[model samples]
Target: MTDAPWSHDLPWPDDLPPFDPFDPAIQADPYRHYAWLRAHAPVVRAGRADARLYLVSRYDDVLAGLKDATAFVSTPPGGAIIPGLLLMLDPPLHGPMRQTISRAFSPRAVNAIEDAVRTLVATHWDRFLASGGGDAAAGFATPLTMGVIATVLGITIDDAARMRDWTNSAVDFIATRIRGVVNPDASVDSYAAMRAFMADAMDRAAADRAAGRGRDTVIDALAALRDEDALTADEADGFACLLFMAGHETTTLLSVNCLDQLARDPAALWWLRAGGSPAAFVDEMLRHRPSVHRVTRYAARATTIAGCAVPAGAPVRFLIASANRDAARFPDPDRFDPDRRGAPHAGFGFGMHICMGSWLARLELRLMLAHIAATTATIAANGRRVPVEGGAFATSGLTRLDLSVTRRSA
Candidate 1:
């Protein structure tokens, strides 16, 4: 991780337990450390000196930070904000851009794609069941999610694979940039390639519209809006890229996590199989094992979070995963109880910057889990599950999860 130009000047409580965000052990399973942080140090400094982080683990504190955009802004002062990237913008710019983009990507738009998503999930599940299951992440979740997002973007199957690769690199680039780290493995070429692809897609959509052939895709919608001067060319392209990158990977991880959790708890699987609510089950899964663990925000002004003083321009890491599991907010937070209800989880985030594609993600997850429960009589771990490397900062889920399943006898 590259050292931040800003120094770690926060008062570090001496009795707080040592915590490192990059530590492989903590990354693998951070619940224990999160618990400690919430109990002893709801807000504290962690990470290396150069890339120091003001970590917030308590649910209330994190929620408040996410809500108060004035105090905790998306981008730091004087920081280079990516044009058209909705997540990186704030206030005056963010609201209008978000409103404009919402026209293209909304709940209604997502609902329109439900049948296609269902078909994709059914097809993938069929193939997996026929083969008695394999690596659920690769054989099922990954391709299934890629197909759904590709459909949403109106991209060809041939382009989906390449887009996935580009999305990975782009995500790595973003994560490293947030951490002040220089990722040697990630490439700027990927960003160029993705942007080029989006531009081409928008152009194609525009051409098709000119020819009186509307595809009714998100790209098509954005293209029309662009023609109306509602969005700039850069904004259109950036929205497409963001949707492609954010849509697939996070959903894929959530699907795999659901499956993993099901394999461990037969009762949960049975409950799902017995016509229990997939939406509720998926909701619990999100809280129990969210795909993305943390999000970094810059302190827009000097403030006190959870009673800890934070300097302006400081990088504050809101541990979403930790917040979801906060005992003070959710009784028996550690337990994975689908029926459990209380405060909403921070799995999809909260406040102004909550995930825009959250509804689509939930739809995909619910349908996939419902299909699995309906079709599969048994689910069991077949081998070791491999975690995504260096996913602690960006996203975290199994890269490979071997599972064996038995189809229900019809």
Candidate 2:
């Protein structure tokens, strides 16, 4: 099979070390490449013909860029095919927009669902244990994430599964589209179907509210907010769509990543015990192997990253996973020390655009590790593992994690 053109499309200076973020090998293990970039060229120009991306690797530069959002905007330099999404908005617009949907994921709301989330996690773990060994990501993490997001969105678990399929199809389609290839999956149709699904759900929610039979879900809240003229219909739909995408995806990756780390360093399982701090371990895992590898920004105006002149509207890609492991910022950056202490890593992110669901994501991870510690004596690799393809530049996660485990006595 011929490799896709984008796979080797990076245009970098000859003086800099060769690095292809799209390469599968690099995706599987990118620390060496990151170290090279951080040392040789903190900010280097790369990407395809039409789109040029500047990679920022050093911890200082990445964090500074993220903190200075005015200079480095979240919206695409040339705008996106799909607009009005929260992450794709800037400044004044981004603030008001986030306010409208933030209530759904407020600390109060997320904490209230702790019991339900615990139940969901236990149920799936029980099934996985019964089967002896299986893909941890598929069997446990994915379903647990799906269930929590569905509950938050006020939808059935079955509907969450259906939504997840549509999400996968849409993501596949987008990947192929970016590569300028045709996909047979009809992902455009799936994208359209998802939009229509959200639209119809919003209408139903409005009608239910008018009749005083309102449902208390994120969808319902967003729709009501729209009715109050707090947001436009399009904004509400965009927020809901983002919730569907980011909500489950990041959490799934975190759970799988933590599990993978524990399996590799079985000794770390001690940290998950009550005597150890599970929350601290979760933070360290994020620093050691963050799910979000990179975050994109647009130079809203002519700016410089690490002294490199970046023209206005040019794309800037921050190698956040690299920043999390910057030796200058964190001592022994590569080591996975649960008790490692320093400044907080850019795992979730930093500044205005930091992950909105961070609280909930942490809650999920903390509970997951606690449960694993309580129920399992040991976890080890049982078979081959396959990492998720295509999205490694943006997200780090496994599509499959086969693990063997021993259950602790009740």
Per-candidate local distance difference test: 0.84, 0.78
**TM-score per candidate, chains pooled:** 0.93, 0.89
> Which pairs clash inside model 2?
none
Point out the worst 10-residue segment of candidate 2 by lDDT. 1-10
> Candidate 1's residue-wise lDDT over 1-410, tens digit each?
22222213423356533567776655767787788778767787776766568888899888988898888888766655666789988898999999998888655667779989999999999999999999999899989988888889899877989988777678777656644556799777888799889889889899999999977689999998889999998888888898888888888889999999988988998998777899999899889899899888998887887666888888898999999999888999889999988899999988888999898899898999889888989999999898866755556778899999999999
Candidate 1's clash total is 0
Instruction: Tell me model 2's lDDT, rounded to 2 decimals.
Output: 0.78
How far off is residue 205 in model 2, in Å? 3.2
Give the residue spans of candidate 1 off by over 4 A. 1-17, 106-108, 172-186
* TM-score of candidate 2 to 2 decimals: 0.89
Judging by lDDT against the true structure, name the best candidate: 1
Model 2 C-alpha lDDT per residue in residues 1-410, reported as the tens digit of each score: 22112223444356543677676766777787788778767777656667667788999998999998889887653444343367767788788777767865555556557877888878888788777768898888899999988877777889888888888777666445433446686468876777678778889988998999886677888888878878777777767777788889878988888888989987898766646788898899889888889988778898776667888877788989999989998988889998888888999888888988787788888888888899898899989788766763788778789998889887
Worst 10 residues of 1 by lDDT: 1-10
